[model samples]
Target: MLPADTESESYRFYKSLNEDILLKPNEFNEWDMQFENGDVVNVTGYESLQNAICIAIMTRFKELKNPLYADFGCRIHELIKANKSRMVEYKIELFITEVLTNMRRVKKINWIKVTDNPNNEFFKYLVEFSVTSIYDKIVEGEVNL
Candidate 1:
């Protein structure tokens, strides 16, 4: 992996795309994307698209976009939007349940540890690691997916 200060053209591009989509009014279609069209608008709430962005990043890093992961990302966004601003104590359990419920619709999730204790640091680490991988994965794609 490159150092933090290392400048990656891919990173810059993803950062720009992330900024664009996050700020776009309504859902912007990929086919209609224009880089120099407008200044970005500020975004307020976290939406399902954000989860899609994260998943896109991860799949991009893998240099391969799996249909499953794409579906997983969309599912993430749906689950997230459905459950807004719950207490911190219940957040992990709710997130796990959401993951399991959605995964059951397709395939069983390979990794799950929150059933024992939702607040476990390991579970937190797993989620964070996956999300961060998405960022790196985006860089790997070197193109918007």
Candidate 2:
């Protein structure tokens, strides 16, 4: 957990892992709820850093088709939806690299692997990547589309 004073200053200060409230008090509201045991939950430190990276990879960019929201998600999903050839795999890897390196907390992206899900008719992909955070912490995870 981050110190209360620096909670707002650090991008890694996410909502408590066990609580719905944001780490920063000013960002909290009545809508946020607490656990029955009164435990404050937030994804701080390495967890928050890793979650941010995962969200960026999973999200599609510029999803204009949905009328409700525009400019959301990454293009990798669109490429998969189009049923592109093997080259799409390379593109997904590049996109993940581009997105992660651009983030302030992401120091470097070690590697990215994009594999097709043969069982899925939609050409879904299984994404796995490792990144070095600014704090020198290495985080890695896989996302299945």
Candidate 3:
């Protein structure tokens, strides 16, 4: 369970999307501040959750340079790079479940839907899922890869 302070707060601390900087709320216009500082603007609530899920799914495990960030991603990318087979889909489902559930903010993953994209020249899948946050907020999102 999330602490009462986290659950009740209107804004949550998150890293910038493009840069490794933290965003904090203040009396000054936050959006302008981000642009002025050359940091990606912050996201809130469902958008924040969706971004996190997308990042986890898209990133390959151990792809990051820092060893401490080694476990922050899923193995879905490996499956995508492998030969197309039924087993790949099954592995994707399992990987998604494991990665999403392990996230600090994700309380539970309701389901993950993987669909084949035959026409896409690069990506072979369209992955979708619904997740319930530790704060009890349910949000659904999709990612193509």
Task: Give me the candidate number with maximum lDDT.
Answer: 3
lDDT tens readout by residue for model 2, 1-145: 4223344434334333211232221222112323434655445556566656666555677644776546445666667555566787888887777777667777788888887774574546778888887767688876665
Model 1 lDDT tens row, 77-106: 223334333343245444544543443221
After superposing candidate 2, which stretches have Cα over 4 Å from the reference?
A: 1-41, 62-73, 118-122
Estimate the overall C-alpha local distance difference test score of candidate 2. Answer: 0.60
- Sort the candidates on TM-score, descending order: 3, 2, 1
Give the 10-residue window scoring lowest on summed lDDT in candidate 2.
17-26
Q: Which is the winner by TM-score between candidate 2 and candidate 3?
A: 3
Better candidate number, 1 or 3, judged by TM-score: 3
Over the stretch 1-145, how does candidate 3's per-residue lDDT look in tens digits?
A: 2122244233443222122222332443131223334445555555667767777776788788887786888987776458866688788888999889778878888889987764564446767899887777787987666
Predicted model with the maximum TM-score: 3
Worst 10 residues of 3 by lDDT: 14-23
Model 2 scores a TM of 0.61
Q: List per-prediction Cα lDDT, in the order shown.
A: 0.31, 0.60, 0.66
